[model samples]
Target: MYFLTSTLNLSVIMFLASLSIPTSGLDCYSCSVCRQPFSKKTTDTMTGCTVCSISQTWVDGKRVTTTRGCDKSCSPADLRIKGNGLVKTCCKTDLCNGNTNLRWFKSVVLFSGLIVFKLTHI
Candidate 1:
């Protein structure tokens, strides 16, 4: 009985995740074409996650830039770049390719804060 109740509680918590849309909604980590070691992140949008890996001829290492807001057409198989030193990847889960340090409770609180911010601004 206790196990069932605890499991149900966790299910409820997960079910109540904010900003989720019906029918394939997802929150992906979003950032633009930022340089390595100094990339920005956003988690308020619904879409697939992407990470573009670049390796410049003059640079000795590779750099990765991530983005969100991709549509249904975006898929892991579709992540590609024609350039010799660029490769992109796509994922279909919330912040799937991003850092996993933030806990679920913190994510919920932060997402709530974002909604409040948007409401106040409008």
Candidate 2:
């Protein structure tokens, strides 16, 4: 009886532990698809596309830096533009920054859970 009880407790603990882990290992921010400070290339020149690159600088007593990039993947800009309608913008259509790997993992986990539940119930 003790062995059976211990096995059941262990199973429950393992199940709860699985839930604690984030099924989605997606870095939504700072991803190439999410932080896309530029537009998709249509031509060789990347015209009208904005480009942004972050760099750290030491200023006076503080370390400060600015996000610099092109206004439209081609045009220069000093700050991040809001709703500028640039092509290939990250996080515009998808919640994740084009993280296909994370998406796949999430889907697999969801489906697997459903299958397990169905099997147990039926």
Global lDDT scores for all candidate models: 0.41, 0.34
Output the worst ten-in-a-row residue range by lDDT, candidate 1. 51-60
Question: Model 2 Cα displacement at 113 (Å)?
Answer: 2.1
In model 1, the runs with Cα more than 4 Å from the true position are 1-24, 38-61, 64-68, 77-83, 99-122
- Give the Cα-based TM-score of candidate 1 against the true structure: 0.34
In candidate 2, position 23 carries an lDDT of 45
Best by lDDT: 1
Q: What TM-score do all the candidates reach, one by one?
A: 0.34, 0.23
Clashes of 1: 0
User: Candidate 1, residue 63: CA error in Å?
Assistant: 2.1
Local accuracy of candidate 2 as per-residue lDDT tens digits, 1-122 = 98986677567557745643434332222322222333322111212222222222334433233222222223212232442222222221112322323234445446656755754563
Candidate 2 residue 94 C-alpha distance from true site, Å: 20
